[model samples]
Target: AQSVTQLDSHVSVSEGTPVLLRCNYSSSYSPSLFWYVQHPNKGLQLLLKYTSAATLVKGINGFEAEFKKSETSFHLTKPSAHMSDAAEYFCVVSARAGGGNKLTFGTGTQLKVEL
Candidate 1:
C-alpha cells in the first residue's frame, strides 16, 4: 500500500518570499512522486514528478522537490513566492507500474499570499 501525508493543511506566505511545503510517504514498493497545484476552482496542473529516475526533480514556476528514500520525504520548495502562487498544493503518490494510475492525493495545503 502507498500513502502520503502533507505536513501542513495551510501555509501563509508573503509575496516575493520563499515557499516550503513538507510531505512524507510510505509505500511497500517503489512509488512515483508528484506535486500538483490548483488555482481556485481551476483544474490541477502538474508541477513536477519523480519517476524513480531522479532524486532531485525540478518543475514549473521555479518549484522543486527532493525525494529522500531514507527519511521517506519529498518536500516542495521554491526560492521565491508570487501572488499568483497563492493556491492549493497537493502531494501525490502512485504506483509506478500500475494499470490505472490511481493517484492518492494529499488532503491539500492552501497557500495564502500577503503583500
Candidate 2:
C-alpha cells in the first residue's frame, strides 16, 4: 500500500520570498510521487513527478522537488514566490496493484501569496 502525508494544511508567503511545502510517503515498493496544483475552479495540473529517474526533479513555474529515499520525503521548493503561485497543492503517491495501479493523495495544502 502507498500513502502520502502533507505536513502543512496551509502555507503563506510574501511575494518574492522562498516557498517550501513538505511531503512524506510510505510505500511497499518503489513508488511514483507527484506534485499537483489546482487553482480556483480549475483542474489539477501536474507540477512535477518522480519516477525513480533523478533525485532532483524540476517542474514548471520555477518549482522543483528532491526525492530523498532515506528520508521518505519529497518536498517542493521554489526560489521565489509569486501571487500567481497561490493554489492548492497535493502530494500523490502511486504503486502497482494486483492488476493495475492505485493512487493515494494527501490532504491538500493551500498556498497563500501575499503582495
- lDDT assessment of candidate 2: 0.96
Question: In candidate 1, how many clashes are counted?
Answer: 0
Reference-based lDDT, each prediction: 0.93, 0.96
Score every model by TM-score: 0.95, 0.96
Best candidate according to lDDT: 2
Single out the weakest 10-residue window by summed lDDT for candidate 1.
95-104
User: Compared with the true structure, what per-residue lDDT tens digits does model 2 show for residues 6-114?
Assistant: 9999999999999999999999999899999999999999999999999999999999999999999999999999999999999999988789978899999999999
Candidate 2 displacement at residue 113 in angstroms: 0.2
Local accuracy of candidate 1 as per-residue lDDT tens digits, 1-115: 8899999999998988999999999888888999999998999999999989989999999999999999999999999999889999999999745566778888989999899
List pairs with backbone clashes in candidate 1: none
Q: Where's the lowest-lDDT run of ten residues in candidate 2?
A: 94-103
Query: By TM-score, how accurate is candidate 2?
Result: 0.96
